[model samples]
Target: MQETPFCLTFGHILPYSMSDSNTTDFTNPSTFILLGIPGLEKAHVWISIPFCAMYAIAVLGNFTILFIVMIEKSLHGPMYYFLCMLAVTDLVLSTSILPKMLSIFWFNSREINFSACLTQMYFIHCFSGMESGIFLAMALDRYVAICDPLRHSTILTNSVVCKIGLAVVLRGSILVLPFPFLVRRWPYCRTNIIPHSFCEHMAVVKLACSDIRVSSYYSLSVAFCLISLDVFFITVSYIQILRAIFSLRRRDARLKTFGTCGSHLCVILAFYIPILFSFLTHRFGQNVALHFHVLMANAYLLVPPMINPIIYGVRTKQIRDKLLRLFTDKGT
Candidate 1:
């Protein structure tokens, strides 16, 4: 949020190398380098155009969905309530990295200040974590709607939904806030160039010149706790969902139910599968998985927001109709 007067990303490399210390405490740097996206094989202008377009579309599209949900009384159902949360999370998620990323790509300015890096990491992880939770809540909503239609209203009550939203906030805030602080507390005397596009925790930690054993342990532990918990819940939910889907005898009824859950299930797989692989690769450090690992990690971040709206737009009649109405309306 700091404007030009407080411009923090105007520096060369750090004075210390990884040889000096195995730890990096968060000392505010003039800028940290981004050694990503730039390496992608494309003309600078070509990549900038597409990346900027994607950022613009991500914001506009997610914001429009949020606005439509807020203004439309008919859209006040639990499904839409969750959808609004998803859209808002998408907007927040993309905003965290896109602007800085686009700026870097366009201006060849990869240097991000230490405080800026920490700030970016905090929200990026927060929204990313929040999205994982929201997806789980969404799957649960689908399950209740499909399997126990009779109890849908009672199970997903107004207060219950509020609690779910609160859980999303608390989950991200409580687990992730301590991380940037811990990183900042460490002393790093190494090159400030980040291997990835954004201030990813693991990547940044690797740059530290001092003993980072505790930080690494706690950070990895926190990551495992959140991601492992998410995967477990999502897997259990889908198992029950599949069991219910298969148990139904009516073909037409089955197809109808599939129509409702298909997109959601697709979204769940799209979002979580890559993330699981990313985590596995990080933990095991298999050299063979390097390229594929980064690819999966990027997809876990970029693909979901891009694909979620498309899935909902194509699969849900209500969402499609609403989008159509917006585009076709005579007055704006």
Candidate 2:
């Protein structure tokens, strides 16, 4: 008699047949099983509490940022426009992963259709690239505003901002367009069980029967090229900005100028540090715990979106003041 196939569910082994009509194929799965943090299976419910809270905060905060930016005409500038773009990108990025993640954790719905997995992977990566580009644009906005204050208005007009936004979108979309296609072509003749809560590209690719060097190399190249170039440009822009700020005659002017960059700096650190850590962990941390890598990956998506609005709201004088007045009027 043929042995029955089994799968792990909430720390219990259950008979899971691959031959069932509704089930995924063993050779080339039509659906993949997400393990939802392998070692921490029993704690998925507890884990999801914080994840759910973060998702809620991300949604509410990003929408709030969008609403504030839209209503406050005074914020109709290059920096705020880039911020709105960032907010939208964060929303998409977090939303792409969190809902399904929660479903897996809370309901034990580990099965994700193949095409849907690719869609999730695409959105997550695409918006992540877009976020990076937006950060570069925002850095440039600050650079121009501080270094060439006189021409700031002329240099980053509404038309120019729109074009920059378009460029960011196009660059991200075009580059990431290949990822799903590449992954789809791979033969997943290995197991369909992915030890992750979401369809992370490498996680899915690892299950392919064929050699994944092309997919791996492509992903690494894209990440390195995008991040390295963006970081270099942002560094250059900030160096110029710092020079301009220090060259100012008045100490108060320097302080005020630096203050303008504080929120952006915080946001940049919040976004990049976790993501870089997660990337390195995924690529090189072979001995690292699987749960650690999974947690970090989720954190990069969740933490930034949740904190970005708070960073802007608290650090930006105009936004803070506007929020206060809006709430105060409501309280009356």
Global lDDT scores for all candidate models: 0.72, 0.86
Off by over 4 Å in 1: 1-30, 38-44, 283-296
| Whole-model lDDT, model 1 | 0.72
- TM-score: model 2 vs. ground truth: 0.92
Best by lDDT: 2
Worst 10 residues of 2 by lDDT: 2-11
Residues 1-332 of candidate 2 have per-residue lDDT tens digits of 31112122212322233434434334456788887887788898999999989989989988988999999999988999999999999999998998899898889898999999999999989999999999999999999989898999999999999999999999999888899998898776535777788998888877776677788889988897677789889999999999999999999989999999999999999999999999988768867877798899999989999999999999999889989999999999
Clashing pairs in 2: none
Error of 1 at 25 (Å): 12
Give each model a TM-score: 0.84, 0.92
